[model samples]
Target: MPIEILMPALSPTMEEGTLAKWLVKEGDTVQSGDLLAEIETDKATMEFEAVDEGVIGKITVAEGTEGVKVNDVIAILLADGETADDIGGADAKPAPASSNAAPAEPSEATEPAAGYGRSGSAAQEDKPAAPAAGSKNGERIFASPLARRIAADKGLDLANITGSGPRGRIVKADVENVTAQPATAKAEAAAPAAKADAPKGSAMATGPSTDVILKTYEGRPFEEVKLDGMRKTVAARLTEAKQTVPHFYLRRDIQLDALMKFRSQLNTQLEARGVKLSVNDFIIKACALALQQVPEANAVWANDRTLRFEKSDVAVAVAIEGGLFTPVLKDAEMKSLSALSSEMKDLASRARDRKLAPHEYQGGSFAISNLGMFGIDNFDAIINPPHSAILAVGAGVKKPIVGKDGELSVGMVMSVTLSVDHRVIDGALGANLLAAIKDNLENPMTMLA
Candidate 1:
């Protein structure tokens, strides 16, 4: 039987994508790891690869096809003895419903290309026997290569683990979620708990339908624009954030006279090396160090618990054409100002081009959304989930300030708002975190120390 090549989910959030281009045509011979197609997910355009050696028997979906759901059979590959005739009589299998399964692990026969990011490994048991390629009933065990390896290493039986992948094919997540305990016992415990914890009904109200909105604006001169994948994902995630996440805002103003002066001197000295730094770079350093100063604030909200981190991974919001990307800077506190600036530039450039990999923009304990460059005064940012808080920075302007001697003086001041997730951080902790950020920014030279 010809192997079905389903549309791969490039990112965890991707539900559907554009089949941008097909690299191989029908009747073309493809070896394992050969480039198959370019899939444009909600985040970026990534190349999909072949997992098995075969000849391309058929192409089900056309190039430039939009809204092609994940797990939909995009193409078919015929093994050594098979040909295109095999596809016609093949029994069509059902696709899974919006699967969250991970990609197969790389093997000796083929190495995964540079762009696709793999998910992290979970807890596992001691080594077990490798599962057979076929099940007891003689049906082929349809599991990802990575899933099979994990199952074997963890001493798990493929027959015991139910797959949540396309056509009941076992993927990485299905294998990782299983524990060392007996499958029956785990399933029994999980079923009742799942039933007890299930929400009674949909608490979220649906917005007015499209027809209703269009009818309401009947006879109006307007163009109905279509929402792209990036825009759609942004809308859904931000809507979920506002509705479900408990957010509290804390605002503060900091004098930036000393910082600006210090920055000028550093830029002048570093001119030969072409290492000029932006105020945003300093802000990144300040927030990263602040997370260290007030360690309690450096955390994320896991479903049932809080995940505290040892290093400060900061996500910086970069606005692009259709939407935005928050490329994360891992271990930001340890990086020098010049290094942070360079990395931010590269990330922002790639983000605008939609070339960032999943890992480049995915995880972070905190995020910074600065509209200061846009000349905005101040605004509260919606917390990007799992993140404990986000710092919203605004423009700096000259303001009158009373000195310790009671004399009025003009100083460059900037307004900032820290939007904290109450689940991971409290009011006092957020305040302290903001205070630390302010202290670092105001006495900018101390950042060097």
Candidate 2:
């Protein structure tokens, strides 16, 4: 029996990916649990593992094949004792048993994603997956489904590869041995050209075609940069957000003197533990508290109705090269300033390395985009869909102001603009949310309460 190995879906939203590398070659013996290949998704380059044992019969797709659609056969595997001559009828073009499943729609039975769905989780499982390929003659291949899939993907000749499993069964561990890394130089060089030929999600949103744009500026001193997967996603999503989401803005300024003092004291006290608190950490806590104080403003637009959460799952924007990541700090209201700060540092570091899983950056009712580090004074951020609001924080500037005693004094004032989805939060609710956040920062002690 010959098994056709198809490209696996690495994420819930992944439609295609680059077959970054192949760890095994044709005629290589494989077992279940072997490392097979490295798949490069939009988020990260992930290691692909084998599930069934078999011999790689043929390699249909070469390494560095980009935009390879999910379920497309990349290779073929031959069953043990069955020579390649017996694989005559193995058709890679046969449609999946269930053809009704749409590429964009996610199925309910969520499987553990391999690379980018969740860090340290199993690979995403699909239903009706090839289970130890069998021939039309009823001869069974004693290989694990996953192993068979891997062999098929690498086009290993099953008859030639020795299986090291129970009763000589093949497993994943026998196939995958190479470390996962970026694609080869050829793939890297071809990326720009690939992006130019790729289809846009929306013709209008994507604007002019690359060819047309290049033609308009022909003979000019200009460089045509390629759009990576992350950039494309960000562009499409943000455009959709601005066009579909009815956004409203709420602006406010908070005196950061007390918060600054509180952060300094906490950092000094926690210095022995190597934990330093940043003003942004305090801001995260304040927003989390505000969500609890003003529960109505914590709601998110779910198309049909507003969905409110008891705990705050705060998404903080961490800018990275090409794009950015909004890693969520789940249950932020319960974490201490030091804990939040520590966890945020970890997420941000991984985000910059493109190591964060989909779940790490996926869900949140509210978001914070702080550009203070860049010396930005004030800015409005576009609302990420499904979330009701996003807070754009600016740098704190020292300015002279009238004190309570009517005397002149200098205070640190930080500006924040909350972009709210009008469909979810009314003006009064938004105002209350901002006020609560302001109060928490102004009195820093109240957050502890």
Candidate 3:
């Protein structure tokens, strides 16, 4: 049988991606683990691998084709003894562009679709089957070989496990973490409750239509700049964040004279080791420790509950072309200043290049967005959801400050605004979190302890 190779979902949030390039062409013999294509998702560009060994009978989706949806047939492969003729009427069509239509629903085909690793064996048909209630319309469950093996050993049902891998494919991590009970049961029970609790009506205005906007500027000459996946995702996510998240802002100004002096000393000593730390590094470390100090504030809203973390996972916003990436620095409180600086630099560089993996830019309870280097005085940041708060750091400038002696003196002062999700953090907790950050920055040497 000619197996259909569907476009893989590279990330959890990826609905569609650009088929940047094809590594193999029709008639090329490919084996498992061979690189098949470079897919550009909203977050990054990743290489897709061939999961089944076969001859590339046809390529349905061409290189440079954008907006290929998940589970849409991208190519066709011929198994042993099968030729291109076997693909006769089975010519899979390219998925419709996401903007124009939704992905086609699964059909009632008895044979499962050939996914990542499965060959769709019928020998197991006689074996006792797990509940197919949660299965995606009897569609094939994509899973890594290791995940399948682990699931078998643990007596876990693959259909019940929600894959976190590309296109929701089950991977080793998914299987290892899954409980003995069927996760689908819980999900089914929660779905209606979640839907009912969701706020009614539209949370945000759609604004004027594109046609209306164009008519309004009929006389003006303009070049239409199409939004790429990254820009579009950013716009959608931030818009939703602003609309849904109940945000409260907490402002603070911290004197950096002591920190400046300490940083200078440290830089001079570490110059031989090629380790130079920036103010942002200190800010990251300070916020991390502050999360630990004000532990009550280090939590995220999970619809029905609050998830608090023992360690601070800090996400720092890195501005890339067209959009930004908030690559997370996990367990920031445990890392040294130099370590954080090095990791931040690496993450930022990769983020700019669109080379970071999805996990690198996801899952942090708090975030820091510093426009200090750009000389921005102060700004309020939007809270990225699931995150309790985000701290917006502004540039440090020389300002007259009244000391404890009531005498005015010039000191470097940096303004910051902590945007809190009122659902997860109260006013007092947000204040405490901001105060801890300020104290940590003011007493920089204590962070080393």
Ranking by TM-score: 3, 1, 2
Candidate 2 wrong stretches, greater than 4 Å? 83-212
Candidate-wise lDDT, in order: 0.80, 0.74, 0.81
Superposition TM-score, candidate 3 onto the true structure: 0.79
Model 1 TM: 0.77
> What clash count goes with each model?
1, 31, 0
Q: In candidate 3, what residue range of length 10 has the lowest lDDT sum?
A: 124-133
For model 1, what is the alpha-carbon lDDT of residue 284? 99
Consecutive 10-residue window with the lowest summed lDDT within model 1: 117-126
- What TM-score do all the candidates reach, one by one? 0.77, 0.73, 0.79
Model 2: per-residue lDDT, tens digit, 1-449?
Answer: 45667677677667678898999998987787788888877776777777667887777789988878665567666668856664453432334446776533212222212221111111222323434233222222344445555655554434444557654555565544423333463355345435534444433347687689878989999766877777777887788788889999999988998888887887788999999888899999999999999998888887777898999999999999989889999999999888899999999999998778778988899999999989999999999877899999999999887988999999999999999999999899999999998998899987777
Which candidate gets the maximum lDDT versus the true structure?
3
lDDT of 2 at 254: 85
